[model samples]
Target: MKNLQKILKYALNYKKYALLNIISNILSVIFELVAMLLFIPFLNLLFNEKTVIVSSLPQFSFSKDYFEAYFNFTMNQYIADNDKLAALYFVCVLVGAMFLLKNLFRYLALFFIAVMRTGIVKDLRKDIYNKILILPLSYYSEEKKGDILSRITTDVQEIEFSILNSLEMLFREPISVILSLAVMIAINPHLTLFSLILLPITGLVIGRLGKSLKRSSSRVQQQMGVLLSTVEETLTGLRIIKAFNAEESSNKHFDQQNSSYASLTLKMTRKRDLASPISEFLGAMAMVGLAYYGGSLVLDGNSDFNGGEFIGYIIIFAKLIAPVKAFSSAYAIVQKGAASADRVDAILSAKNPILEKENPEILNTINENIHYNNVSFSYNKSDIVLNNIDLKIEKGKTIALVGESGGGKSTLADLLPRFYDVSSGAIEIDGINIKNLSLHGLRSLIGVVTQESILFNDSVFNNISFGTNNASREEVIEAAKIANAHEFIIQLENGYDTNIGDRGGKLSGGQRQRLSIARAVLKNPPILILDEATSALDTESEKLVQDALTKLMKNRTSIVIAHRLSTIQNADEIIVLQKGEIAERGTHSQLLSQEGIYKRLSDLQTFSN
Candidate 1:
C-alpha cells in the first residue's frame, strides 16, 4: 500500500486534470442516480391508479421529505392538468435527458483521466531515466543489467496495466456506490442494514485472496527479471557459447528459468481471476437475503412500505452491486501493481554517492599540476585497491603507470574523473581539492581513450562529435586526421556520415580504436588519460594507434597505463605499481639501473617479444 502511495504521488504534478476528473465524476454520479430513481414515480402512477395533487407549493427546506413532497406536488399538478399519456411523455423525455447528461459527464471524466494517466506515466519514465544517468558506476557492479532493464520496461508496463487501468474505478466507483447506497437506506434502513452485514464478509474473502496475489505477483516479476537476464547473457555470449559447443547447456538453463516464470504467472493469474466470480457469488447471496426480508414487510400489509417503493429500493441496491464488484476487482489488480511499483521505486529512490558541493568552484584550465596526495581507494572497506599513493604530474609532462592487472591502474585513472571517489585521501588539481570543483567542469578538462573503444550505432560524424557539441565538419575531419582515421573513414559507404553498426561492429578493431581516439582528439583537452589504449590491437593497428597517441600527447599532461613496456620508454617518468603501492619511479634507464620490479617486468616482456 505504501508503494502504491509512492507511485500515486506523481499524480499530484497534474492536479488540474485530477480535479476536473473528480468534478466530472461527481456530476455523472448525480445524474445517473436521478435517472434511476425516476422509475419509482412511474411505478407509483401505474399501480396506485390514483393521483394526489397539491394546490400550492410548500415552504422549501433541505430535508429529504421536503424535496420529495415538492417533487410529488409538481408531478401531480402536471398529471391533473393533462392525461397520463402526456405525463408519460414528460417522464420519458426527462429520463432520456438524465441519461444523456450522465453519459456526457462520464465521457468528460474519462477525457480528463486520460491526460492524467499518460502524463503520470511519462513523468515516471523520465524520472527513472534521469536517475539512471546520474547513479554511480559502482551501482551497476552489483545489479544485473537485465534486472534494471526489466524494471524500466516490463515492470513499468505492469504498473500501467494493473494500477493505472484501475485509476478510473478507484475514483468513480466509490461515489456511485455511496450515492446508490444512500438512496437505498432512505427507502428502507432495515433492508440496507441487512445488506451491509453481508458485504464485509465478501470483502474479507476478496481481501485475503488479494494479499496472496500480491505475494505471487512479486515472485512472478522477480522471475521475469531472471528470465530476461538469462536471455541477455545468451545474446551477449552467443559467440562464446557456439565456440565452446555449449548451445545445449544454454538452452537448458534458459528453459529452467522460463518454466519457473511461467509457473509463477499461472498461479498469480488464477488468484487474480478468482476475485470477480467469488465476489459476485457473495453479492448474490446477500441480495437474495435482502429480497426475502424486504418482501416480508411489503406482504405483511405494512402501509408505510408500498410495493412501488420496495421495488425501487431493490433497483437502487442492484445498481450498487456493479460498482462494488468493480471496486473489488480493482483492489485485486492494485495489489498486483503494488509489486511492480516497489521494483521501480528501488531505482528512483536509490541513493547517489557522487554528490557535488552546493557552491563548488569551476575548473576552467589546468595551470600547475595534478597531485594525488596520499590517495587510497577501495571498492569495499576490507579490500583496498590503491593504498596511500602519492604522485604528481606537472603540466605539459607525460607520466606512465605500468602495473599487473588488478593492481589499480585503471582505478587510479577513474578516480580523477570521479567515477568512484577515493576511499581515504584527496586528489588536488592546481592545489585545489578536486572535490571542491564542479564535476562537469573538472571532467571537461580531462580526455580519456580507454581499451574498449566504446562507440554507438550512429554516424561516424555523430559518434566523433558526441560530447563535443557544435563541432563543424571541418573540425571533425581535422581531428580524424590527427587520429589517423580519416583515410579509412572516407572509404566507407557514406564517409563521415556512415552509420557504424552496433558498438561499431561494422568497422575493424583498428578503425574502432582510431575513431575513439578521434573523439578524444576533437575534445582536445589539456589533460589526457590513456588506459591501455593499444593493449588489445594487432601489430599493424598498434603501430597506427600508437603514432596517433604520440601526436595527441604532445605538450599535454598525460597519464598512460600500458602493459607493453616498450611503448613507454620515451615517457618522462614511469611509475611501476606493485600490490597497490609505487614500487619504482624513474625514467627507463634509471628504473633499469634499480634492477627491481620494473626491471624484471621489462626484461620479461623483452624475453616474450
Candidate 2:
C-alpha cells in the first residue's frame, strides 16, 4: 500500500485527465442503464400485457411516479392507435440511440486515459533516468546495471499494462455494477437482496486467488531481473567468452534462468486466468438461484411481476454478471501491478547521495592547498580500504602516489572529488572542510584521466568537448594539440567529425589515451588527478602518451598515481602507500636511499621489464 501511494503520486500529476475520464465514464454508465431498461418496455409489447389507464397521461415531472406512469401511458397509446409493430420499432430505435451515446462517451473516456497513461510513462521514465544520473557512483558499484535497467524497462512496462490501462476500468466497471444493481432493485428488491448476499462469498474466493497471483507475479519479475543480468553480463564479456571458449557454460547458465522464468510465468498465468471463470461460474449459479426464487413468487401471484416482467428482471440480473466478473479480473491485475510498483519505488526511494548541508559554501576556485587529516575509509564498513592517511597537496606543485595495485592509491585520489566520503576524519580545502563545500562547485575545480581512458560511442569532437559542451572548435583543436592528439585526429576519415566506436574502439590505445588527456586539457582545471595514465599502452605508445602527459602536467597542481617509476622522477614529492597506509614519503632519490618498500617496488618494475 505504501508503494501504491508512491505510484499514485505520479498519476496525480495529470489529475485533470483522470477526473475527465471519470466524468465521461459516469455518463457512459448512465446511458448504458437507459439502453438496458428499454428491454423492459419491449418485453411488455411482445407479451401484450396491457394495463388499462382510467386517468389521462400524467404531466411530465422529475418524480419517479411521473416518469414511470408517463412513459407507460405513451407506449400504450401508440399501441392502441397504431400497432404493436410501430411501438416495437420506436423502442428499438430508442435503445440503439442510447447505445450510440454510451459508446461515444466511452470512446472519449478512453481517449483521455490514453493521453494520461502515455504521458505518465514518458515522465516517469524521465524521472527515473534523472535520478540514476544524480545517484552517487558507489550506488552503481553496489547494484547491477541489468537490474536497474529492468526496473525502467520491464517493471515500468508491467505498471503500464496492469495499472495505467486498468485505470478506466477501475471507474467504468464499478459504476456499471452500481447502476445495474439500482435498476434491478427498483424492479424486484427482494431478488436483488438475495443476489447481493452471494457476492461476498464469491469475493472471498477471488481474493484468495489474487493473493496467490501476486506471489507468483513477484517471483516472475525477480526471475526476469536475473535473466536480464545474465544477458547483460554475456554481452559485456562476449570477447572474453570467445577467447576462453566458454559459450557452452554461458548457454547452460542462461538456460537454467530461462526455464525458471518460464515456470513462474506459467504459474502466474494460471492463477490470473482462474479468477475470471471462477467468478463467472459463481455469478451464473446465483442467477439460477434467483430464477428459482423469483419464479416461485410470479407463479404464485405473490409478486406484482407478470411472466414478461420476471424475464426482464432475469435479463437485468444477467447484465450485472459481466461487471462482477470484470471486478474479479481487475483485482488480479492490480495485484500484479503492485509487485511492479514495489520495484520502481525501490529506485526512487534509494538514499545514495553523499548529502551536502544547507547553505554549503561555494568552492569555485582553488587557492591555498588540499589537506587529508588522519583520514580512514571503508566501502562496507567491515574492511578499511584507506587507514589513518594524512597528506597535503599545495597549489602549483605535483605529488605522486606509488604503490601496489590494491594499495589504496586510487581511493585516496577519489576523496579529493568526494566520490566516496571518508569513514573517519575529513579532507580540508584551504581552511574549510570539503564536506561543507557544494559538491558541484568542488568537483568543477578538478580533472581526472584514468588508465582505462573511458570514452563514448560518439564523434571525436563530441568526445573531446563532452563536459564542455560550449567549447569552440578552436579551443578543442588547441587542447588536442597540447595532448598530441591533433595530428592523428586530422588524419582520420572525417577529422574532428570522425565517429569513434564504443569506448573509443576505433582508435589505438595511445590515441584513446591522448583523447582522454585532451578532454582533461579542455577542462583546464587547477587540479588534475592522473591514475596510471599510460600503463596500458606499448613502449612506443607509452612514450607518445607520456610526452603528452608531461605537457599536460606542466605548471599545474597534479596528483599522479605513478605506475611506471621513470615517469614521476621529477615529482615535487612522492608518497608511497603499502596495504592501506602511507609507508614512505620523500623524493625519488630520498626514497631509494631509504631502501624501503618504495625502493623494492621501483626495482621490481625496472628489472622485471
Candidate 3:
C-alpha cells in the first residue's frame, strides 16, 4: 500500500488528465445520484399513492430528509392536477433525461481516465529506461538482464492496465457508493442501518483474500523474471545450444519455469477473483434482509416510507452493488501492483559505486604519463586479482600486457577507464588521480576495442560513428579506409547504410574487427586500450586486423593485452603477469635478453607456430 502511494506520485506528471478525470467523474456521480433519487417522486407520480395536492412548494429544511420530502410534494402537486396518463408521461421523460445525463458524464470520465492511464505507463517506462542508462555497469553484472527487462516491459504494463486503471475506480467507485448510501438512508433510515452492519463481514473476507493476493502476485512477478531470463539467455546462446544438441534440455528447463509461472499466476488470479463473489454474496444477503424488513414497516405503517418510497430505497440500495464490487476489485488490483512496485523501486533506488567527484578535474588529454601507483583490484574482495601493481606508460608509447588466463590483464586495462575502480591505491593520468577526474571527460580521452566486437543491430555508418555524435559520412568513410574496412563496406549491398544484423553478424570476423577499429579511429582518442583484439581471429584475419590496429595505434598511447606473444613483439614495453602479480617488465627485446618468463613464453609460441 505504501508502494502504491509512491507509484501514484508519478501521476503528478499528467495531473491535468487526472484533474479532468476527477471533475468529470464527480459530475457523473452527482448526476447519477440525482438520477437514482428521482425514482421516489417518479414512482409516486405513476402509482398516485401520495394524493394530497399542495398549493405551494414545501419549505426547505436543514435536516438530511428535507430533499426527499420536498421533491415528493412537488411531484404530488403535478399528479393531482394532471390525468394519470399525462403524469406517467411526465415521469418517464424526467427519468430518461436523468439517465441520459448520467451516462454522458460517465463517458467523459472514461475518456480522461484513458489518457491518464496511457500517460502514466509511458512515464514509468521512460523513467526505467533513464535509470538503466545512469546505473553503473556492475549493476548489470549483479542483476539479471531479463529481470530488468521484465520491470521495464511486463511489470510496467501490469501497472498501466491493472493498477493505474484501479486508481480511477478507487476515486470514482467510492463516490458512487457514498451517494447511493446517502439516498438510501434518506428514504429509509432503519433499512440502511441494517445493510451497513453486514458490511464488516464482507470486508474481513475480502481483506484476507487481498493479503494472499499480494504474496501470490509477488511470486508470479518473480517467476516471470526467471521465465524471461531463460528466454534471454537462450537467445544469446542459441547457436551454442544448437551446436551442442542441448535443445531438449533447454526446452525442459524453460517449460518447468513456464509451468511454475502459470501455476503461480493461477493462484493470484483465483485469490483476486474471490473478492467479487464474497462481497456480492454478503451484499445480496443484506439486500434480501432489507427487502423483508422494509416491506413489513410499510405494511404496519410504523415508518414514514410508503410502498413507493420503500421500493425507491431498495432501488438505491441495489445501485450500491456495482460500486461496492468495483471497490473490492480495485483493492485487489492495488495489492498486486504493490508487488510490482517493490520490484521496480529496487532498481530505481540502487546507489551507484562508480560516481563522479564533485567539482572534479576535466581531462582533455594525457600530457605526461598514465601511472598505476600500488594498484590492486578484486571482483568480490576475498581473493585479490591484481596485487599492489605499479607501472607507468609515457604518452604516445605502446605498453603490452601478456599473461596466462586469470592474470588480470583485462582488469588492469579496465581500471584506466574506471570501468571498475581499484580495490586500493589509485591510477593517475599525467599528475592527477583518475578518481579526481570527471568520468565522461576521462573516458573521452580513451577508446576501447575488445576481442568480441560489441556492435549494435544497426547500419554500418551508425555503428562506426556511434559515439562521435556529430560525425559526418566522409569522416566515417575516412576512418573505415584507415582501418581497411572501407573496401568491404563499399562492396556491401547498401555500403555504409547496410545493416550489421545483431552484433555485426552480417560481417565476417575480420570485417567485424575492422569496423571496431574504424569506430575507435573515428573517436580518435589520445589513449587506446585493446583487450585481446586480434586473439579471436584466424591467422589471415589476424594479419588484416593487426595491420588495421597498427594504423589505429599510430601516435596514440595504447595498452595492449595479447594472448599471442608474436603480435605485441614490437611494443615499447612488455609486462608479464603471473598469477595476480607482475613478474617482469621491460621492452620485448630487453625481456628476451633476460631469458625469463617472456623468453619461455616467446619460445613456446614460436615453437607452436
Candidate 2 global CA lDDT score = 0.87
What is the TM-score ranking, best to worst?
A: 1, 2, 3
Candidate with the larger TM-score of 2 and 3 = 2
Which parts of model 1 are misplaced by more than 4 Å?
49-52
lDDT of 1 by residue, 15-66 (tens): 8988899899989988988887777777877888344456678789866567
- Write candidate 2's Cα lDDT for 383-490 as tens digits: 889999989889888999999889999999998899989999999988789999998888888989999989999999999998986999999999999999999999
TM-score of each: 0.96, 0.96, 0.95
Model 3: runs farther than 4 Å from truth?
45-48, 58-66, 69-77
Candidate 3 lDDT, 437-499, residue by residue in tens: 999899999999999999999999999999999999999999999999999998999999999
Between candidates 1 and 2, which one is better according to TM-score?
Answer: 1
Q: In model 1, which range of ten residues has the least summed lDDT? A: 47-56
TM-score winner among the candidates? 1
lDDT of each: 0.90, 0.87, 0.86
Error of 3 at 150 (Å): 1.8
Q: Rank the candidates by lDDT, best first.
A: 1, 2, 3
